[model samples]
Target: MGHRFELHKDVELAATPEQVWEAIATGPGIDSWFMGRSEIEPGEGGRTRLTMAGHVEEATITAWEPGKRFADRTEPGPDGTFTAMEYLIEGRDQGGAVLRLVQSGVLGDNWETEYEAMKVGWDMYLGTLAAYLAHFPGRTAAPVSAFRPGAGGPDAVWAAVTRAFGLAGPVAEGQSVRLAVDGLPPIEGVVDLAGLPTYVGVRTADGLYRFLYSGAERGDALVLGHHLFADDQDPARAERAWQEWVTALPIG
Candidate 1:
C-alpha cells in the first residue's frame, strides 16, 4: 500500500447543521472562516479556488450534500502530490451538531513530521471556525479600522474612517447598519454624521459596547471613546469591546 497519512478531529458546535453548512458553502463564508476569497462552484465536478493568507490553491468538489457533507480533492504542494479533504456534519442527539474534518493523502519523505505540523494548523483553524460560527452565524465581512492623528480636523477624521472602513458605497447618513468580522460578533450601529461635527454610536452583537465614536476636535488631536459592559467580564468580551471600539474609529 502507498504511504498514506490521515488526520481527523471533531468539534461540537452550538449551531445547526444548516448554519454550519452555510459558513462552509458560500464563497465569502468560506473566506471568512477558512481561506480568503474562495471561488467555489458547488456540486459534483465543480471547482474551488481558495486563497490561503496569500497563496492560492485549486481544488475540485467531489461531493456536496447541503447541511451534511462537503468533499474536495486538490493537487498537493509544489512537489505535485495530492490531497483529499472532507467535512462531515451530523446532528447530535441533544441538539446542535458535530463537525468532523478528515484529511488524507500520500506523502513524500518526512511524512510523519509534516502530518504533525498540519494537525496543529487544522486544530487552530477549526477552533477559529467554531468561534466564528458561535458568535456570528451567517455573516462574513471583515471590520474596517483606520486612524488619522491630524488631517482636516473632524472632517478629515470622517473621511479617514469612511475610506478606511470602505463605507463610501451608497450609505445613507442617518441609517442603521450591521457588519461582521471574522472570529467576532456583528456590529450594529448607525452613521451619525457624514462630515465634520459628526458623532456615531454602535451597539455590538454581544452587547459589550453601548457606544463607540470619534469626536470633532479643534486641533490635530481627536478623541475616541468606547463604552464597555464592565471590567470584570470575560477577557474575550473585553477584547471584543475594545476591538469594536477601535474598529469604529477613523484612521489617518
Candidate 2:
C-alpha cells in the first residue's frame, strides 16, 4: 500500500440522533447539508456515491448501526489514494447528538499539504451544515438595517425601489431575483421578509443594512440601510445612497 492519510471531523448537531440519521440516510436530506447527491443503502455491505457539482466519490459501507454508527471504505482515486470514512452519532443527555466524521487511509508524498487543506474545507463545510440544519426551513437572504414610514404604503415603496433599481431580469421560478442599481453592479438576490411573501429588493453588501428581517415588524414602511456590495465601490457613497433611497420611497 502507498503512504496513508487520515482526516477526522466532528460536529455537534442540535437535532435528535434520528434527525441527524435521517439527514444522512435520505438523498434530499444529505444534499441539503453535504452538497451532494448521496445514495446510502441502510445496512452493512451497502454502498454510497457522494456527488457534488458533478464530481462523484464512491464508498462502500463496511459497518452500519441504524442511527448510531456508519462506516465506509472509499474507492481509491487515480493517484492511488483512498480513505476509510466513518461517522458516529452519540446521543447526548441534552436531547441532541454529537456526530463525528473520521477518515483514514493511504496518501501520496504530500500528505501534510493535502491534510491542511482538507482541515480548513471540512471546518467550513461542516459548520455550514450544522447551522443550516439548526435553522431548517429558514431562508437566508439580504439583511435589513432600518425601516421607517415612507410617503406611500409598502406598495409605493416597492414601486419606487423597483423603478429606480429595476429587476436585473426575470429569474427562473425557483431562482433568486437580481436587482440592478445605477453606478453599481447588480446585487445577487432579494428575499421575502416575514409575512411578505413576494421577494423584496434589498441591497445588503454595503454594510448599511446591518439587521435582517425576521418576520417581526409591520406596516408599509420603506425598509432600507447598507446592503452588501463589492469593496471596489466607495463605501461612504454606497451607505449614503442606500439611506437616501429608503427616504425617497413613498410611504402611506
- Best candidate (score: lDDT): 1
Reference-based lDDT, residue 171, model 2: 23
Error of 1 at 244 (Å): 20
lDDT of 2 at 159: 48
Over 1-252, each residue of candidate 2 has an lDDT whose tens digit, in order, gives 367767878899888887777766655556444433577776888888876434778888898887898788977778888888788999999777998998788876767655764665565446545644565522221222334543444444444554544443432222344554444566654332212222232323332122112122323344442323233556545545555555554433
Model 2 local distance difference test score: 0.55
lDDT of 1 by residue, 1-252 (tens): 235878898988888998888877667566444524578898978998875324778888988999999999986666656788899999888988999989988776657655765675565446546656765666664422222334445555556555534466543545566655445445665543232343333334432121112332223433333322222335444445545555555454
TM-score on alpha carbons, each prediction: 0.54, 0.53
TM-score attained by model 2: 0.53
In candidate 1 the C-alpha lDDT for residue 10 amounts to 91
CA deviation > 4 Å runs, candidate 2: 77-79, 137-252
